[model samples]
Target chain A: MTAPEVVSEDPEDTPAVLADEVEHVRKTRPRTNEDDMTLVGSVLGGLATTWLLYERVLPFSGALGFFVSWYLVFLAFYAGLTAVNRPRAVVVDRVMTSLVIAAPSVVGLALASTVVVTLSHGLPALLHVNFYTHDMSGVRPSDPYTTGGALAALVGTLIEVSIAVAIALPLGVITAIYMSEVGGRGARLVRTIIESMTALPSIVAGLFIYSVFIAHFHMPRCGFAAALALAVMGLPIMARASDVVLRVIPGGLREASYALGAGKFQTVWHVVLPTARPGLATALILGIARMVGETSPLLLTSGASSFLNWNPLHNPMNSLPLYIFNAVKSGVPRNEVRGYAAAVVLLLIVLALFLLARLVARGRNRG
Target chain B: MAGSSSLPTRTSLRVVDEVEDVPRRVVARQSTQDLAFTHGVRSVGFLTLVIVSSIGIFLGVQAKPTLQHYGWSFFTEYRWLPNLDTIGIAAAFVGTVEVAIVALAIAFPLSLLSALFVSDWAPAWMRPLLIRLIDLMAAVPGIVFGLWVLLFIQPQATHVAHWLSEYFGWIPLFKVHTDVHYPIWDQAPGFASYEGSAFIAGIAVSMMIFPMATSVMREVFSEAPAGEKEAALALGATRWAMVRTVVLPFGRSGIVGGTMLALGRALGETISVLLIISEAFKIKWNILESGTATISEVIASKYNEATPAQLSALLTAGFVLFLMTLAVNTVAASIVARSRSGAGTEL
Candidate 1:
């Protein structure tokens, strides 16, 4: 090949000339100030409206005040940003202006509506220390507020969920393994069927269990049957989630394991399963959350009990969902209060599970 | 000649050795069979299929008697009084369909707009906060939403009803009834009671499904390829025009799938409908006037007191609900499959 071509450099070229060109380039670019401001304004306006509405309309003033003050602080920050004329100044200006315009009226309307509702419905019964410690066996609508608590319902819910997890976890995990690791044509067919089952309604699961255990076998409604019904609801979700998590495991890890003379099962257990553990945990917790809030299945299978029933097979179990359903159905003022309390408790339980699952997922992601 | 003779002798010896290895292979196969038998994943998968099938089979068997008695006639008959031996699911079916349609009509546009706001219109800093709020809305239980709407929204709807009558009395839908006993017009003009009406039930169901649809649509819209949007922008399109032409077309199948899934959810929703709809089986076309029962509501309300015939009728209704859900789910799955295949080729 011929020798490489050589080029001569211009002696007049200087660092100052390059710097000036870069600066000129930067100055010619169009600024996004107007676009960002409009966006920020609209967002602030919407949030201010929603926050004001939710707060003033909340059943408790405590939550309302907490949120209102929270939004105002954010509003102030926006105003400060705008005053500083930062790159994001237009965004801040828009937000502050929108909040100033929208917050008062929405908040006022929400507060007015909430007051009317509170007066008509009265305050939800205070859940005292004993509310978590007592059973509802002796409680009546006309009885004093000290009659009993939802301790039994709490215990029953725990037991039902525990048994449901026990049944669902291994089955779901194994099914997922089959779908992701060893799945062939037959496995695909099985997976399709399971996925279809995931969308079956809670009521249908209940009716199926009710017909099988109660009508045909002459069995009484019990916590075990309820747990079984919940397992039906939880299984497909757990299996599908687990399958997705398993499929997402990098192929390199599996190859590394196989190169170490590990068998298929060993590779799956030691390498793949650990990698997907967080997602699996999330799936399990989600299953628990889903079953915990289900009322219809528990209604048909577990029935309802005022008192605690530790024996899953022998007695009707008191669960938060069942308790809420019964209280609402009773249509007594005291019962409605009880319903709200139970609802709050149920919501807390599901929220706790979801948060825990998310934490585990985040931890695994970092690793 | 001596080397050739040695080679033939070695080959004969190797052939003899190969024959001996066959029995050893059979023994190895038996051990592998034992290994496979010990592992339980395959067995567990099989067991799950069996259990799930048994549930469906058991329900079918239990519902067989009702099916045999009514055959195909049960669906068309409207009356549901079992003590008098008159039972049909026609009115309940109509109410169910009507409520689902109306709720979808109300929820679809609202959710689409909300999704657009969250995905495209919101500021970068605000998007996460808005998404979190949407999540909170999704997390609120159906029963809680039903209670809130019943107590809060119903009163406002009544006011709107009165306003419509006062300002636009010529409309048939806004005609006011003056009967004091019925109380359609007796109270404050707008404050009509919806104690057990289809309209209230529809609104409650709409609220229940709105968050799900919005979240799904938001995800689909956000996932649209950036290049397509950029191309539209480069060709001189407004933001709304770009969304209408590029984003919507890309997300149409996804939206349809989401809506169908929501429809399935609405069909099976029991608690909200039970709280809002009336127990009556009568069909009233006027949305603001009266309540009509749905299949889910009827089952929830009457399951405890139902006789064998009535119970069978409910089971039949359950079967119908199952079929409706299956159809919707199948359609959604097919759409999802089609989109996935299309995406694969494009990628």
Candidate 2:
């Protein structure tokens, strides 16, 4: 076909020729130097402002200063770009409009949370060392001695949590192993039920334990009951964790054991269980961590005692969580101090568990 | 045919000769015994189920008396006075529901947004950091959160209430009496005090619930099919529009599951609510003015001091709470099952 005939039919030739003419005209457009500089300036300005806001050399309120400075810099950048390159104004305006619309909600939440945290915790955390060591005992409401250390409560918490961990770990691990390795249809059903039990509230666990041990069994109000309650609370978590670990073990190992003339029990004990040992440990630790800081179950099952009791069965044991609870509930100033110290301790314990879990997981991954 | 028959006869003769060898029969019997021993290992798995069920049975037996006495009226009655033998769980039920609903209302949206920011909108380097921050928040025990709120948040709440009355007294919720010496007062005109009120409890509960909901939602959001999001974006949709259309639809069931999980956590929370609120069994409608009791808090405060009848009543309440949680979990599991089935078909 001839070039003109290929380009257009007799009816379509006019529009095609006009579109090519318009394209040729547009290609001759020029760029301005000021537009380039404006782009560079905006980029630099955003970076500089972000750096200053984050670096914290100046005594500016962290959240408020960062937000205000970011917006102002962004606004200036958009304005500069618009002034230099009018055609790009639409893009800049759209971006700026959305940011403006969204900024308040984000900034407002950040600011409110920061202010709350500072006012509530920051100042009191700076006050007396008495909050750390003393109990509410002997502290008079009118006297400066109204605040005492949380020593007794801390001891109580340690004993209660320790007892809880002792009960939860073995039960959780064995149950998990059963579900994954030896469980048949009935076993699977049991696992499903246990998984469902994960949704049981802490209080229900407490009430259940209380009714069974304290009311019906006539068990004394002590750390042992609290431990039982927490163990029940931690069971699902431990079972789930152990089950996941067991399932992840390769089937080839089990088959190899059978080929070597090992029995099912022997294979599971020596091969499957060993391979998942790290995860099992992690599960146990997690269970301990979960029950250690639980307050509700402990509150109902383990009556609060002001004095430290090492024996789980003899007397009411104070746990860190219970200590904090009792102190704060009393609405005494000294108790508030003890409460904060206990809180700090409890936080540290949780943090330690988390770190330990991460470490074990990493070791397993590497191994 | 004759040759094949002779071969079969020869093979049988060889097997019979081998069986006749000394120790062959003994080995076969030993193998049978070993198989039985292996089977015994499998039988022990039932012990876990036994332990779990035993707990349930024990609880049921203990709570029998109260359940028998109240029949169904226990749930509907609003009064809870153990000394007067007029105890009912109505006020505790209301407090539990009110606190849970209000906390969820506040935490749900913020958590969704925070999850979105971390999983989708955050810069690459910031994602891990934000995730760790969230994990840290979750790691903090409920007891610590309660202590922080009581010692720190209470004073600020008082000041805020005072400021609100001074500036925004026209608003009903913020009204405060200038003549009152306490920063927060129960009898402030048109305004309720923060002391032992549902509002404080709700905020504390919200703080406790936020980390759980956020972490779950983040995981769910990040797991959403990439193609779905890309397809929405390809249709000239904005980031928010894409999320609204593709991400949210896929995550709806997950969000529901997560919320139910969080509801379980909130329902069981004892120390925080107990420390922050008055253990009063009054069914007050005002969030600010009323001191309300929750099931967990009531049990915690009264379990030691309760008479036999009171203990039975508490056990009944405990049983009800247990059933409520089980019902919630069943619904959640069904929703999850449906979503999985739906995904299977799509695949």
Candidate 3:
């Protein structure tokens, strides 16, 4: 938006040439310093309407509904203000501009509210260390919510998710390398299938593992079964995300490695992959994030247990998400309170991972 | 080539003596390491292909019986009673479609606007932050979404549903009931009197889906040909006119593709709906009704408890849901791929 200085036309130039030269002017002009009554009025009016609807008039459904209804009112009010002084086209422009602002507010508010509400409800349970440290084995659901913690569930989630990551990471990243470095019909087919698998539902993934590994084979309802299901969900997502990261690698890096007499596989391994490491990490984070909070898959594959089960293969294990699901459904106030607290912890973890993933993904790009 | 070089004989010794300087053998430059490395990578790639196929095959095999036994009745019959030798997912089919419709109806315009907001209206310093926030929204887990809605939305939305039913009974969709009784297997199945409803579930789903739709639309809007947009604005067209004439048309395919992908996700979503829906069998007209089951919810609820035949039925339902999402994503992916390839050309 920096303004360029005006240059006078050459005095000796012909009119036709001079007129053609003027076409080099900037397409969009900077707004003058004049007062913008339209914006001022729109802001004032939009707020008035929003306050009336959200604060005084409507019994809004929590923050999301309030914001949505408030936004609708804001949009109407802004457009009406602009319509009076502005031409038809300007009105449209103003309205769209206001809407752009409104959209973000609504989305932002909903996200903020989700986190806030979770934390508020979860705070009371978090106040009790037992909620974090104790298992629910001896504590009844009807007992005071402070009686037990999600320690068993937390340990179980780590064990299972670790197993899933162990399985998915190598296979997923290598597959991505294959897709990006080895150009062939097989790679293309793999890419397409991976893309399709990205949409495979979490519940279906659980069902698949449940039927094959648990029911048919009569395998134990342990963390391993859950891990297998989670691995299934994680692999395609990681592979696809890694593939996208690998595709953006500069072609010259590959050629440069080739010129140094590195083989195709060596070029992929030492060069292409190293260049895409940060993005690959992001991909891994994204894949893991998607799987970590998955309740339905774990619900079916890993039978819930109140006692801590360290070994994923030995016995049934509980996960944080499943624990949350169980506690929520128990309909006891304390259990419900415990569920909300677990949810808050889960949210914090997911949010942190999401932020770290973005930072890692962006760090290299910033270069 | 290695062993034969050492055993070479001078059969043409006299002729070879004149051409003595000529080399006896040629060596290929390729190394053993290179061969081993690429082959390993290639195998890993193909393993991906195997894993994908097995899922499809296994699910299909599991679902085969119910599909074969019931034939087309699986899609037409309404009740989900498996104990009396009857299991049908017609209600789930309708409920999924119904909720998805409502979600899309609510989500599309809002998402479209948010996309534009991030792309156009956001201040320069705020754009990156806004985009990151949108992406963060996608990371919120489905279970969390359920928790949010179950606690915060359900209680409040019931009044709205009741009022809508009371005033707008003329409209079939808005028509709600205060009470309904349908006892099945000694359990009260019909539950219009309660808090759980498709409308609330749809809202939760829409929240989950909003980020994706907005980000997609944002990407589309961001790619609108800069030169064309400048031209439109230079012609005294307003910002809205410029966007309408240049951006909207250019991103038409992107919008459709994005919405379809969101719909695909919404249809297969499990935890949120499972936590919210009242889990009834009949296909209800009013989204405000308490008991309505989606295909995904059905699978999650019945996976452990179902009988052998019922398990197969659930698998068939899951298969049907899988096929639907697969079809939707494939179409959307292809459209998105095609549009991406041709994106630069439009400018």
Candidate 4:
């Protein structure tokens, strides 16, 4: 198709043939049509110019500098091309549209790069079955990559997270029930406190548990104490999320139960809770996700262990996050690779939990 | 047949009148089970409050000895030498703010643009997936980001730091006191000086908090009045103009609240900062420099090896961080609540 020479308010300057093509349509939608060639051409031109500037003209050599300058040059090119036929306002709008679209792409690129880099760095450690089967009990940081693993940390994380879930889930849901179903002055106060508690630094939870249990109470640093710290961090998150979920449960369902002569408790048990079950699962998953990767809390409450200790209450337990922290901080390249591998495991677990939550949420939406 | 219909109608009318005539003061009688359940829920709620509050109380109590020993000097002293019986959080506080500022500076614009794009520019079929992508970003553990920063980005970031210091050296915040001259495209010996700066730590943290801020802003942007948006479009406003005038104004409080929430998270961010920063116990304003200490990072790095006295000092630092985050979170929550009500948007 022939390009429009100049699109303007003056009738003759506009393309009459293109106008005729769109005339039969209502044309009520926002005018967003643009030349495909201009978009492609500007981007290519920008890349070429940036390469020339960086390699031939400018002294800049880093990838970051090149990409940053390329983006700026691309915007300039886009503006220059669009302004050829379009008004200044239209040119500005087009440039902004490109920018808005570019922002998400940049974010997505960063995320993708992080995943790729992490996998590349950690994949070697994960190749060994030993990585999943053994603990670093006697292995030194300078040992070969296959000599030790994070099996103890993996088991410890599962134990501690489950205990935290067991402690916090019921209380969080009930607190949500209180705020949503049993409205009173105290509920309001409790709600405000809970909201603020959600902001409590995860480290503070560790400090609290350390002081109260390990320091003052003379308790051993065990996975149970770490679990308690995780519970402290996870409780407010679960309560807040579950509160929102419960509040979204339809009131009509509650009234239906009440109209059937069911008491408040029975109605809540049979009606409200059932209706919000999927949402509650989401809250549960989210709470787990929030606490599962908490290193600071585990660092303080559960001292790092190099043994495969199954019992959470009896000994120092190592979770995945603490394992990563220790390994990375060990300043050994081999150990740091193992740490990255454990981080990959942690990321996968979180991803799986979130996917499950999403599945439940989707089912609820369809139902 | 007429008598039968009239009798039923009279019965219905009687029922309707009975319902309408019922006193407003009438209440449902609670069964014993209902009463017990309500009390159970209330008590559980109270238990949660107790559990959460005990954190604050425990910190306050554990920190008491250290606070008493240090007096106001705790706030004034910059060094943390517990071995010498000297400790303070003044520098840590400044470092926390510096890192948070750098994080928010990088995160805010990115989140705002991403939210706007997702809400306005994305095709309907792609919206949910985009949202999920953002949410997934949030689920990535901080340790992973820290690893990425320490291993991958730190080297590349050193170059950017050098460039910034070269161009913006007049701004003290970007200045580094190195003797190395700029345009050093190669990784010179002096480049190692830029490796563990607050700028690098902040960049890692910015990624960690970006998803949260984006989700909040997206929620508010979607709640912009459809009528107003359409009216602006109908009035020949360009798509960008419509967004600038309608969506931006409507989402203003969301931006502020989201920024503050992200700031709160950045301030308390532990693993990433701990991984990326080299510990220094001096007040430093230059984020491009390599030595600074944040409250959470200090606590994390020191807690394992600290003496009881040092532990108490660390707890005091934790207490301060807790208060800072709590205040930021409360204010952000209130702003978000107000905006939600004003927009009449349900979660």
* Per-residue alpha-carbon lDDT of candidate 3 for residues A101-153, written as tens digits (9 for 90 to 100): 66667667767878888889988889998888899998988787668889999
Ten contiguous residues minimizing lDDT sum, candidate 1 chain A: A103-112
- Indicate which candidate wins on DockQ: 4
Sequence-dependent TM-score of model 2:
0.73
TM-score of 4: 0.91
Best by lDDT: 4
Error of 4 at A1 (Å): 27
Ranking by lDDT: 4, 3, 1, 2
* Tens-place lDDT digits, model 2, residues B1-347: 00111112222223456457443232212245445644554454456566666666755776788867876667777777766767788888988887787678867777777777776677799887777667656666776667656655665555444544555666665443344345334345523444767667877787788877877777778878999899977886666667778877888877887787677777767778888887777766555544788887888788878887888788777766777777777776666545443221110
What stretches of model 3 exceed 4 Å from their correct place?
A1-77, B1-29, B179-194, B342-347
Which portions of model 1 show Cα errors greater than 4 Å? A1-124, B1-39, B124-139, B161-193, B234-236, B341-347
Model 4 chain A — which ten-residue stretch has the worst lDDT? Answer: A23-32
| Model 1, residue A239: C-alpha shift (Å) | 2.1
The DockQ-based CAPRI class assigned to model 1 is incorrect
True-vs-predicted CA distance for residue B250, candidate 2, Å:
1.9
Q: DockQ of each model against the real complex?
A: 0.19, 0.27, 0.36, 0.41
State each candidate's chain A TM-score.
0.70, 0.67, 0.83, 0.90
Error of 1 at A34 (Å): 8.9
